[model samples]
Target: MSRIAIVSDIHSNLEALVAVMRDIEAKRVKKIYCLGDLIGYGPNPNEVIDIARDNFEFVIKGNHDEAVAYKIPKRFKRLAAKAAFWTRREIKPRKRPGYREQRVRWQFVHKMPRSEQLGTWLMAHGCPTSNLEYIHDNETALQVFANEMGGSRICFLGHTHVPGIFTMDGGEVHYMEPQDGKRYAVTAERAIINVGSVGQPRDGDPRACWVLARSDGTFSFRRVKYNVDAVAERIYREKGLHTSLGDRLFVGE
Candidate 1:
């Protein structure tokens, strides 16, 4: 009856996060784990952080979260850089009356770990070791499985915003595409699971996606539709924010 809900890349889309949480609660999951990117790209960074702090039991730091807390890497594209800078101010505005409260929220993300080990499972925003790396393809996923030294046989990750699975067996790597409502059995082969994005999905699907991992060594991907237009409209209304950020929500980029 107990299940661990794995979520990631929320990207400050409150509407999508709310819908995903609703579906997660409906499934009666006991513990929720977030793989990070709680803010960035969207309009509601503080709201997403508050929900993440309140709901998720385990949280790992994401690249966007790092960019906001620390320095934006040179590798970051223009849009992401812009969003990170905007979020930095939005969370802890210079002349805001509630600076203390905003600082607390920012500190929450700063306190998150780059990776967490839970028994046989490893959770990270990107790869197990690097929060900025993207384990989207089989080669990259296999590299992490081989390089990372940890007891966890399974690694749950996010960052590319596309849900999929990679298995390492007998030194060979294979990738699996997940289906909604279908459970895939976890084998002795080490695996890396991408839970996709809760806010902005980039796999050509606009729905919010998360992973439902049971204690019995099986997991499933779930997608839920939310009010993309509402969030997009809100993004458009916010000044100093990119309009394309709102437009991409409708297309899932």
Candidate 2:
């Protein structure tokens, strides 16, 4: 139960990812797990995938990951669907100098599991029941704890892009907004933690968000500031990516 770092919803933002990785390294964290959404909504799908493939311990499949890798039905909203489609075209294998490497990266995303269980903890992009499902409230967290957790004490997930802690004790659930760098002890019978988004954070904070979980039953949320303007400019230059995507990064909406 060594300390581990969890990151999610990278959304192909290379600047943010690099910044988070640097912070993780500075903290001397060894094992890193990704909750997914490795691609989509940004300018560097291939580059981001390459880093995840090379560094992460494992990456669970997210809704965007499933859509981009398989070209499945576009179930996302208008803007998200457009980004996924654009990402699909951008990451598709082509006759290039690194064709073999490109194919390997595509396969990595294709083979990602919807969920992974590690000892008493479960890791998923969204929820254990489905990758598309989001646990944004106490009711959803309670339902997941009662039905879907499958006896795990803690469930780590990301998809809402907002970092928070949900604890179920004696059939009552409580939600808390995790403050940056504060380690909250997990004393509840069951808990669900959202590690938040590395690329796109919706908690009104423009900085990247991640979590550091320790073996002592405590975890801390971390925020790292990166060059958002660099990523936004890249998105603006790419005709396939909507400008709204760039604009949201500034406000973290």
Candidate 3:
């Protein structure tokens, strides 16, 4: 049996990453898949990237990753652009020292692919139409589902930051609510699972994030609480980050 642990949207929060890794290790998962946005909106960007390099089994690129590597368009939501710009700054601080190393690391993140398949799952930060598309609900997932998966039966996505699962077959779609503390069976062989965010979770629940455990033909979702207060404190001390970004961690809204 092969067990895989899936995580996404780490956002450079090292504390959260550590907690998630500890928990994932406890489960003894052999493979770990990251759905992208590995850096952004958090402190310790360089350290987090380094750790991902050492640990993650597979990594996919997200819009934020693209923004840091390549020049993202100014037309792509001004607020998002601002966040991505700020994230780049957080990753690569100048004058003090280590700026060059950070720049190189950012380049490494950009090198990540937009989509990839591992085992039976296709991983992408968002819908296949665009790496930035958010898959938050059934209607949206259905619209992008058919086109995104193409030949693959299962597509795992991030970008929504909300943990959810949606399956579409024969033009009919079904929504699976976030699992409750246990691994939910994959049930259908062909399905799409959104692994959710690792650092930033906006699913109304204030836990670190969600992970999918896949073995054979069954998959389960598990939530593990990390040091939210520690991450919040780091964000607060980190200069130039929008205060609201740090504030949202308390409620996980």
Candidate 4:
């Protein structure tokens, strides 16, 4: 593949997922990787899971995926924990005539790995070591950089629902704001890149986000606009999902 498409935190929004898929197809990108969170906090968890399993070449397990596949952890907040529990029950196999087997989707999430290393990059749901941890701030980024064992030159992660780049030069970490289609060089300096969230974004932007990594060691952040209102309405119509999930889609929080 000339470009490897990377996406993460797709919390079951079909509209956003479709939109991102369309963008990826238009770019003629074949190989794709997912940083999990395939289920929870949105409508159509099964559909999202199907897309991730069928399309993405590599997948990393996120906190929500772990919760749904095994047990919900106490680390999740009230709404997130509720959504994870709801999704666990929602993905149960049922007698739907035209639909694919729900058990396959559950199995897909169950088989996800917490981290995967490819070339010079390490893919993870949150960070390299912990899936529940957040690298949104500089302090956390510093710790993550400190824990680096010199195996991977770059770490691609998603959990904070924010798209940005963190570079470590001479033991000092620096954060850079990411823009759509903006490409950055991956040098010998250690770096961590968040591909952002596909279903739910908390970076004050409602657009679906992803990343494109070229063979030349350059990364481009991409965002696509999707129908948030339609997805939000579907979330409201779906049973067991909280209305706040729908509310947050509009604000991207």
Candidate 5:
């Protein structure tokens, strides 16, 4: 197996996506997997989806993606709901020159699966069973290991927008924050790895977060800096998106 890159929660920030893709390319990673949320809460939904469709090998259906593509009811807050609605309006096919292309991209998002199994690893936008679930604590991690792993030794997730590693061995579970460029050996009986967010990082660092997994049973977290102010300004200029969406980029909240 070749080394692969895992990214999630892009949230349509074109600058962050471009910067992360450049970093991935520089690392010589050939395969990239996306955990979804390709749109919503950012200014460039269509552009982000274009890049994702062109690059990622597979993309799991996230809550935001689901809401936007299907117009399904989700537990989004006021701002997120507003953004999702706006994204729907933005990506919805229209009677324009690019109508065919737009419909194709919309269908691409609409057809994304909820979960994918890669050899011994399971990939999901959140937990295996639900894209809306958040595996944020040891208890939730243990629950996933017991009930949701579906016979995989490792599960890769990206809904919390915070990078961390959870390992279960000898009937004990341990959680650790992943550091940039530090490779963590995948020796646990079961593990859940959160690759964090690519466009809207909430880990307080503000840089885009992703993970590089090697064929040698180890993975390292990577973060790349981009022009946050530019994206924030774009968000502010967009009438449908709220200002807080852009403001959060500066603080990584």
Candidate 6:
């Protein structure tokens, strides 16, 4: 089976991204798919972009990424807006190198569709229709599944930062704990898998979010432990980053 890694929401935590990559390497995975938000809410935004540009096979844009390339309006949650603003400043030429490179990639942010369907599998950062929607729970899944249900047998989603599986088996929903690196075979029924957050987790779990897909339509989920303290300290040290962002690393909320 050819396993490809699915990573999302690194949010500029280089330590976490590196740790997750180590986990991927240990599994011998080289092909990677990114669900966006590589920069935001933490340090080393450029480093995250560098690694992704060098490694990822497919990438979708996240709301935070779009906010940076385009102007984020006041309608966005102020906290998120603040983080995007701070992240843009932090990744500037003086603070972070590779701004031009990142910007070149950032320009593609707007072009990323809200969702992607590859044969039997679909991929998206949030809901199929909205990049900013949060598919965190079963209710959200029900609505999204109903809309995107088609020939595609499975859908992979992120942006909720809570890793879990929501399966539509004969019009019923069953939620499973994220697969711990073992592919869970799928039937003809549809499924929506939230890949979770890599740098920052919010499912009362501090580990990073991940997913693995094989050529034969088999897939798995992985959440690896990284240096949370290192990420927390960096955010705390950054002048413009809010304390709440740093403090959440401990709670994963």
All-Cα superposition RMSD per candidate: 1.3, 1.1, 2.2, 1.7, 1.0, 2.4
Q: Estimate each model's TM-score.
A: 0.96, 0.97, 0.90, 0.95, 0.98, 0.89
Error of 3 at 10 (Å): 0.9
Q: Give the whole-model CA lDDT for all candidates, comma-separated.
A: 0.88, 0.92, 0.76, 0.87, 0.92, 0.78
Query: Which residue pairs in model 5 clash with each other?
Result: none
Indicate the TM-score of model 1: 0.96
Candidate 1 whole-model C-alpha lDDT, 0 to 1? 0.88
Please estimate how well model 3 matches the true structure, expressed as its whole-model Cα lDDT: 0.76
Candidate 6 lDDT tens digits, 1-253: 5678988888988888898899899878868888877777887776787787788876788888878767886677777788888877755444356657756555554465556677777788877777788876778788877885566677787887888888887778888886566777777378887888898889888888788777777788887888888888888888778878889988888
Clashing pairs in 1: none
Error of 3 at 51 (Å): 0.7
In model 3, what lDDT does residue 142 have? 74
Provide the lowest-lDDT 10-residue window in model 2: 70-79
Error of 3 at 90 (Å): 3.9
lDDT of 4 by residue, 1-253 (tens): 5888999999989999999999999988869999878878988887787788789886799998899889888877888888888898888666775335787876788889888889778899888888888898888988888885257888899999999999889988889998788778976478899999999999888899999888877879898999999989988986677898999888888
> How well is each residue in 1-253 modelled by candidate 1, as lDDT tens digits?
5698999999999999999999999999999999999998899999988898889996788999899998999999998899899888889645568777787797897898888888888888888778888887878877888898367789889999999989998998999989988999978479888999999999888999999988787889999999999999989997757999888878877
* Model 4: per-residue Cα lDDT at residue 119: 79
- For model 5, residues 117-175, the per-residue Cα lDDT tens digits are 98999999989999999999999999999888888999999989999999999878999
Model 1 misplacement above 4 A: 93-95
* Model 3 ranges off by over 4 Å: 75-79, 92-100
